[model samples]
Target: MTEIRLITFDLDNTLWDVGEVLHHAEQQMRQWLDANVPEYTRTLDRDALTKIRTAVVTERPQLGHNVSALRQEVLFRGIVSCGYPATEARRYARSAFATFFQARQEVVFFEHALEALGELAASYQLGALTNGNADIQRVGLDRFFSFAFSSADVAASKPAPDIFHAALNHAGVAPQQCIHVGDNLIDDVHGAGSVGMHTIWVKLSDQPNTIGHTQPSEVVEDLAELPGAVSRIHTA
Candidate 1:
């Protein structure tokens, strides 16, 4: 194996608890809607909101990469469904999404994630490649990463080779000289492995081992163990 030159990462579960952050962000968005778009809030229930989001995604499949646009579109259509005019719905949608986006950036890093990033960044080029729309800079994590890419920017989500290839291009390294770290077995492990990159599976959930051509080269329970694990892989 080539010496690891660039270490790419998946943002959501690798560095922070995204599920909890999103829950709080959604709550904040709901509160803002109740205060500003009372009529829309009153008209749409939780189930109705899911239906509207589903409809939005179904109608606009291109949003598969851009989660922010997908959410804003859902807000706009939900407002329209509440009988608001297009212009009014557009205004409310922007405001509501702004509320959500702001709350979304208030992230809490996982145990040892920051220190691990600092140590890793000192030795290797670090890049963030994520399917979600989380802004590394906005969340105060930009200092650790040399570069960042999102599904929105590249118009291609992971599990596809395009995003990884984009990272390779920017870093000017061969796939063999890169390793991708993330929580998801498929998106991070299988995806990077398929492109001939080393893989580290952050086992945060009860996901089964991938049963295919790609598999993790290493697995660690937390970020604290990552540096050592990465060293082992690179030296092997």
Candidate 2:
């Protein structure tokens, strides 16, 4: 077996429960908007904002990869529609997005997440490959992750080959010398596998592997099992 030199991780659900973090962040952002730009809060509801997001992505498909831009554009449009001038709308949108982004970084890791990363980082170079807008620096994950890439970095999200290829290039490793660990079957398993890298599926639940055509080299339900799984793959 080729020696595994790099291990790329998905940040969102793999490291922490993103749904709760996002919900809390949204509330914090909404509170900021209400205090600063009451008009936006009064005018746009969740459904309305969702429709604007859909339109924004529809007109500019490239924004799909850069979620930060997509969200800021939505805020700008919503603020403008609420009768704010373009200049004020842009300023408010940026401020609101910053507030949301800061709040978004407040993540609670899964049990043993830090410990597992520490163990893995001792022997292998650790990288992060995420489609979401979570900043590793803001989240204080920079100590564990030597390099990080997001969808925005390569203008392509997972299930696409660009981000994985970027990691390979950055690490200077062949596909067989890398392993990608992520929670999603399609985005993590299929995506890395498509690029000829080994994969470990972080199955947080009992959901059956519905993607029958693709299989991960290892499946682990908890981060505690991560180092062992990687060791097994490395030896095999």
Using lDDT as the measure, the top candidate is 2
TM-score of each: 0.95, 0.98
lDDT of each: 0.89, 0.94
**Cα displacement (Å) at residue 163, model 2:** 0.2
Candidate 1 error regions (>4 Å): 209-213
Tens-digit lDDT track of model 2 for 1-236: 66999999999999999999999999999999999999888888889999999999999999999999999999999999998899999999999999999999999999999999999999999999999999999998999999999999899999899999999999999999999999999999999999999999998867776766679999998899999999999999
User: Candidate 2 regions off by >4 Å?
Assistant: none
* Candidate 2 global TM-score: 0.98
Q: Give the TM-score of candidate 1.
A: 0.95
- Which one is best on TM-score? 2
